[model samples]
Target chain A: MRPFLFSKSSAINQALAKKNGTTQYIAGGTNLVDLMKKHIAEPESLVDITSALPAKIEVTAKGIQIGAMVRNTPLANDAIILAKYPLIAKAVLAGASPQIRNMASTGGNLLQRTRCPYFYDVTTPCNKRKAGSGCSAIPGENRMSAIVGYSDQCIAVHPSDLCVALAALDASVKVQDKSGKTQSIAFTDFHRLPGTTPERDNNLPANALIHSIEINENAFAKNCAYVKVRDRDSYAFALVSVAAALNLKDNQIVEARLASGGVAHKPWRWLEAEQYLKGKTANAATFEAAADIAIKDLRAQSHNGFKIPMLKGAIETALQQCLNR
Target chain B: MKQEYNFSRRFFLKTSSALGALAFIPKGVKAFYEEVKNFIVPKKEQLPLTVSINKKSYAIKADTRTTLLDLLREDLNLTGAKKGCDHGQCGACTVHIDGERALSCLTLAAMVPGKEVTTIEGLANGDKLHPMQEAFIECDGFQCGYCTPGQIMSAVACVKEGHTKSVAEIKEFMSGNLCRCGAYNGIVESIQKVAAK
Candidate 1:
């Protein structure tokens, strides 16, 4: 919470123009402010962009467009999102408490940092915080580290339940650049696999700003659920979570979408398992098989090996609940 | 790349010219420019803040790094909102911003200028206590009462948001407000009593 310059912007171009490597955007201030207070993030200048971005929840023939500044509570309680995309709503509600949901913005949720204990303790060596400093979680306390798509540089997991559902729903993120140019990034490709540069969380450029998220209308609405297994029932990060959506016809699955959280650097979308579930009967056996396939490639650390089976059970339960719904 | 550079340059010129035109306007636009300038630049790390708290407007100067929780307790002497776990984990600093519950500990003071903030101090109307506050007292919702204010604020919001239909829902919605004394039963009862009406 060091003294920093603060500016408010009502224009996107103006905000983006002032943004750079040392300047950070503030919206809701739930995650960013916490990081700043912990000294994990100390930007010299903060450009408040809550007013600069649109806050509308517009529904079109193709899909729904959620503004970046839309608070998590309103997004979760919105009639369109709750009815047409209950998985998204459930995932959002499962993640944080009511007060947090009131202040957390859609775009800020996507950009939230990992909740690794080592990352928060500045005295420890964390590559994500200080590049090339070596990751403490690699050999230290890593019970919550990533189980898949992790490099030696960092093993932290992305702690977001909303992003998992968005990945399963095939959402798209709209971003505007400092030059006033815009581009769309698919939800699956929005977050990056932690490689040499664990410092870079997502594929977004330094000067780019998230505009909105577009989710297409799909048949998974009737049979979808977000199952999160945590240390506690509420107010805790997920130990393993699953966002399952299935299209069932005549007791058989026509299509399926499965993604996992709390186990990877990004939302782990098991495309192979999703493909395997299709054309199979919507039963416990099919779900168990899909869950097995989903965990086959997961490489767990010494302390987090339990997450492998825990994630498998979560996936099975999520699929069963989706079918039952 | 070339087109992007040209566009950015043109945008800068357009904005500067717009500001230049505003400087010549008689009164209204000039005052607007002054407001915009104040918002864009922090004067010596202290900014002018106009916030409405407890239905009272206060024009004050706050540091750019000051959080709403600190501003309330340290500046305004509104100590009803306690600061527990200064981060967003504990909900001891919960307050209502524009009728929605938010963690004041995480909200910066600069962000509440145009919004209405209602803290536990504002819950009681002079001599009459709020329904949720009265219910908390009737049910003995707290043991040590350290987290009572935050719990009461969240409870009121939970009922208004229609999440208090069942015991499980109330527990889930009020999970942020941690009561270390383990008086969860009374807290649930308090919320239930208010929701029943």
Candidate 2:
């Protein structure tokens, strides 16, 4: 790794003012350090923002506000999260190893780059790594590539199980810029599709710091499930995962939210399918139809067509689990 | 043909003139030129750090790019924490930062100034082995023993976190520390033994 200046400060505005395109903010350093060691990322300066960001999980008028620096393990095991947002806890637990969860911060996890093999292998052409460079995954080994919301420029999927649950829960990301101005971005809009600018993963403004994530109270806490299908039962990225939540009244769905992972650049959400499930009886048939609608417009690359059925089954299974609960 | 002696007056005059010109350059411009030169050249940034490790404090100079794992094994000579993958994929570098288990390889040494770091070397109290270490030995929890330190560290944390309810739970919690020798049975038994106590 190249040597660079490292500064630690508790002032957000000062850190943001120092941040440039070549400067990075280090929180947990779980992913950033690894990428730096691989020479995939070479930041000229790194501001240690772990102290700069808030680390508290606070109860708000809205359900809860998770500070950007909250570690994944604490977030997963938080009593409030386990009780009020069980799917979020389950999804966090299902994603990485215990040690990683212990060190990975919430904001860092949201900003983690894709685990696409080409992106890691510097020799390969990865548009996400180098803008305008040809994407090797389109014609090369792409079994783990995106199956939905993929443009010709890139076919990489966001690899956060927590983000999928957040998308389903309609969480909002609050950010602060160098001017100390703050704004909230809906969870679904936080991550971007890999359009012509695959190099840019999220819509977070440059040099802005993520403040916190706000999730509103919902009735689906008791009837929500996060189902992740992967090659292994532990410590692996999802091949296809689903976060399903439903609000039920008299055995009929009052509202539904579904988001999928490992199949899209962003957490794939089907609002139309969710809208279709509303007022419908909660059952396997209805869930199957919803799954079909969710997968109807999804197109797969050459090697990732299997993800279509995997995603459909994952969605159905997750909804069925939610229904059973 | 014979090689000629090349100590020419013209070369000496040119070198002296360049040195004379450099001496006349303004201090600010010279500093700027040095800054540009530093950017073009790769140089290690050495910073003074005071870190607390295993209840002991040490003030040392470390490269800004050095990982906590390297600072432990290479600088501090605490070789108990092994580097398996050095990429956070393998748990051989597991250590405690502020009593919480974390991968030292992923942690920059500069980041742990105010925090306490406990490595495998700190687990045992002088001649007395930690309970988790004793359990591992009693249960034969390792074969090659490369991942033993990390496994013991993770197992200790797992038990303390109240995640050692069953064999499956032990396996799940200890999945980060991979034992390529397939000695998981003994590892799980060791964790269960410690948790049962």
Candidate 3:
């Protein structure tokens, strides 16, 4: 890795002011350091913002506010998260290893780049790494590439389990700019679809820093499950994962929020499927119908065509688990 | 916003003089530019880091890119924490940072300035081995013994965190530390033995 300047900032304004296009903010350094070592990310300066950001897990009147610097381990093991947002906790636990979870931060996880092999291999041409360089994953091995919301420029999927649950929970991201102007972005809109510019992952501006994530209190606590189907039982990325939460009243689904991972550039929310499940009986037939609607518009690549069936199975299983709970 | 400046005679004279001086002494100008760059931008050459390891405080100068695992093994000669993957995938580089298990390979040395690090070398009380270490030996928790240190460290933490309620729980908690020799049975037994006490 190339040598870079490192500064430890204790204030948000100081960190934001120091950041330019070539500067990156480091927190946890689990992914950033690894990417740096691979020469994938060569920032001229690194601003240490771990201590600069708030680390609190505050329970506000609207809902829960998770600080950006909160580690994945604590967030997964937090009592309130386990009770109120069990899907988030389960998703967090399913990602990475225990040691990694202890070091990864909430904000860093949201901004993590793709795990596509072509993207990591600097020898290969990747549009995500270099704009208009042409994508190698398109014609090469792309079993893990996106099945929806993909462009010819890039097909890499966002490898995050936590964000999938957050999307289902209808979370919002709070970002603060250098001028101290703050704005809340809906979770569904936080990550961008890989249209023409796959180089830009999210809608976050270069100067703005993520402050915290706000999640409103929902009634899907008792009926929520995060099911990640990977090649292994643990410590693996999802091949097809489902985060299902259904609010049932008198054996009828009053509301449903379903999102999928390992399928798109952003968390793939099946709004149509969610809308179809409303007022339906909690049974296998209803779940199968919802699953069909979820995968209806999906267009998979050559190698990842199996994901359509796998996604259907995962959605069915996750809904069944939620209904059983 | 600051006002943008247009080209002027004063700016041209200032630039021409700087170029003329550099033309007269090209080597000297290059050296001066490097000196100014170094003075302005902080390089990774000599970063002052203060960390407490095994209850011993050490003030050392490290490169900004040096990982905690490299700082311990290369700088401090603490080779007990092996670097199996060095990418945070394998648990062989697991160490305690402020009593919590973390991957030293992924952690930068500069990030551990105010935190306490506990490696495999600090697990015992002089000649006496830590209870988890002893349990590993008694249960034959390792075959090749490469991943033993990390397994023991994670086992100790798993028991301490009260996650060793059953064999399944131990397996789940210790899933991060992989043993290629398939010594998982003995490893789980060792954790169970320590948890039983």
Which pairs of residues collide in model 1? Answer: none
Clashing pairs in 2: none
lDDT of 1 by residue, A92-132 (tens): 99989999999999999999999999889999999999999
What would you estimate as the lDDT of candidate 3?
0.91
- lDDT for residue B31 in candidate 1, whole number 0-100: 83
Task: Order the candidates by lDDT, highest first.
Answer: 1, 2, 3
Clashes of each: 0, 0, 0
Lowest-lDDT window of 10 residues in candidate 3 chain B?
B38-47
Query: What CAPRI grade goes to candidate 3?
Result: acceptable
User: What is the full ranking by DockQ, best candidate first?
Assistant: 2, 3, 1
CAPRI category for model 2: medium
* Candidate 1 residue spans exceeding 4 A from truth: B1-44
Best by DockQ: 2
Off by over 4 Å in 3: B1-28, B31-42
Q: For model 2 chain A, give the 10-residue run with minimal summed lDDT.
A: A2-11
List each candidate's DockQ score: 0.38, 0.72, 0.43
lDDT of 2 by residue, A180-211 (tens): 99999999999999889999899999869899
Measured by TM-score, the strongest candidate is 2
Question: In candidate 3, which residue pairs clash?
Answer: none
